[model samples]
Target: GKVPILLPPLPEQKKIAQILSTWDQAITATERLLENSQQRKKGLMQLLLTGKKRLPGFEGEWETRKLKELCAIKTGKKDVNEGNPDGKYPFFTCASEPTGSDEYSYDCEALLIAGNGIIGKTHYFKGKFEAYQRTYILSDFSNAVSVSYLHQFILYWLMRDIDREKQHGAMPYIKLGLLQRFNVFVPSIEEQQRIAMVLSYADQEIDGLEFKLNLLKQEKKALMQQLLTGKRRVNVETEAA
Candidate 1:
């Protein structure tokens, strides 16, 4: 059986199409801007996090330190099943977004690293939260390094570390020893904070663009619903007879 399709009058259809085209163009432009903003942030991360591009009036030698020296690392005792949607605390699993849990495990600013699935994926949170058994928590950061800075550094370097592990014939996953031995280049605390702040500003811009893109898409969808159905009529101008 063939399905019947309802179409508007030729002029009205053309007008609707034209209106939708405008929205399409806007969506495409916003998508391009979002991509460019993300690329800009990635470039900034590569330069600033590596110390190759120093911010104004900050000049000093960067020291290298092992992960163990910078913070205490441990795995969470809770499992994925422990997460509760209505719980009080954020329950972190290997996934990107945290679920909820009533119980509190750790209370500090730390980096949550996915140990297995989505390996090397990291989340930075500065409050009380629970974690999955496979989630590695790095807390009690040394005064020499800012936890925010370390979070940014790990995000920049973690992928490379994973690739290196693959090159060494090991499975792609975060091990306790890997965290203990990973090397981080340390700049002064003040410089670290400055770099993190700049990168964060870049993040905020990207987020705002994303929110705009979503809104544009949603608006376009609503327009399509109205125009395609008989719910809303289009005004198509006619030529003089």
Candidate 2:
């Protein structure tokens, strides 16, 4: 038995191919922009968060304080199995993204750090949310510290510190004591806010680039389906004239 194939006229086929090729180029350019933006943010975080490069009009020695001095640290009561996909609030575990949950145990501006598995991974959330038993929540920030700045600081430093703690033959994990004793370089709240704002702008740029990339890819996919299946036909003769 011979299979039937739906093929368009040569002129129409060429027009469709040209349209898809343009989409491909746009998607590739957006992907490279997204990558470059991410790397730029990473570099900015290292410099501004560490006080190695100061923003204009700010000059002073930063204070070094232990984590316990800046905020209260505690763990969540819920287990990983308790998450609900259709629930109302965020359920944070040791993973990268939060799942949905019906119940929330804490309500505040807080930083959540994974205590085990993927040790040192951190998330900052404000408002009501549930958390896994092993996730460390840092809240009740001191007046002198900016929680936003602290979150950025931990994002850059804690993971690097955790990497050094990984022993030969042992699974890496974070202990309460390690967090309690962890040191942070604290600038005045004003300087902290300034640095955090610059980094936040960089994040927004990266996000915009990523959204554009997704839209381009999706448009190309839908166009391919329509053209290849003959659901949409190109008017090659009109375009040529």
Candidate 3:
């Protein structure tokens, strides 16, 4: 069987190719930026968690602590309907985003761990926030060996352990008891704050770049759709006969 190949005129084809090439370049640049961010974050985690890299204003030997030894974990109250209109508290759920409640649940700074479904996801919350049943809220900062240090340590440790224990099934589950047994390496409070600040700054930059890249891609897509459909023609035109 013979296959027929249809080709556009040279000029039109070149214009199409040039537009696609621009998209390719944008995609490649975005991918490189994403890869760089991931690599940098991984490197920072390795160094900061292990005490290989020391931040400014901190000098202390890192310590090991069981997760349960440092913080008190509280299951979130399942009271979404109790949200008060004049309340000023942020409501949290198993997912990272805030819920539609203004009532405060936990009254202090703490780390929130997802208790079911996509388990082991952690978020640091300050002041007060209402938490749902699927989340475990950590409290008792004074009792913690070092609150800031423990927070970072637990985050890294939780992610590692959860990835390891996740079963090959439809859903991943991390039992609260199992999670509390996870081990962690902790530095002094000062070191913890320093490491968190540095990594957080990097994360902010990466997020900003991602937002800009998304906007650019959206603009490029709109341009391509308009130009290809002839709704928004470019300045170039076909030569008259």
Q: Backbone clashes in each candidate structure, one number apiece?
A: 0, 0, 0
Look at candidate 2 and tell me the lDDT of residue 150: 89
What local lDDT does model 3 show for residue 88? 77
Higher-TM-score candidate among 1 and 3?
A: 1
- Candidate 3 segments whose C-alpha is farther than 4 A from its true place: 1-17, 55-60, 79-90, 102-104, 143-148, 167-171, 237-241
Order of the predicted models by TM-score, top scorer first: 1, 2, 3
lDDT of 1 by residue, 63-95 (tens): 999999999999999989978989999998888
Q: What residue pairs clash in candidate 2, if any at all?
A: none
Residue-level lDDT of model 2, residues 1-241, one tens digit each, is 5988777888887898898999999999999999999999899998997888999999999999999999999999999999997889999899878888999999999999999877888989999999999999999999989887888889888877877667553446788998999999999999999988888899899989989999999999999998888988878978631
In Å, residue 241's CA in model 3 sits off its true spot by 24
Estimated TM-score per prediction? 0.90, 0.87, 0.76
lDDT agreement with native, every candidate? 0.89, 0.89, 0.70
TM-score of 1: 0.90
Q: List the residue pairs that clash in candidate 3.
A: none
Over 4-111, each residue of candidate 3 has an lDDT whose tens digit, in order, gives 644455676567657767877987798788779977877887788888878877787777776777777668886545655355776766655555566665678888
* Clashing residue pairs for model 1: none
Which ranges in model 2 have alpha carbons more than 4 Å from their true place? Answer: 1-6, 116-119, 162-171, 239-241
RMSD for all candidates, in order, please: 3.0, 3.0, 5.3
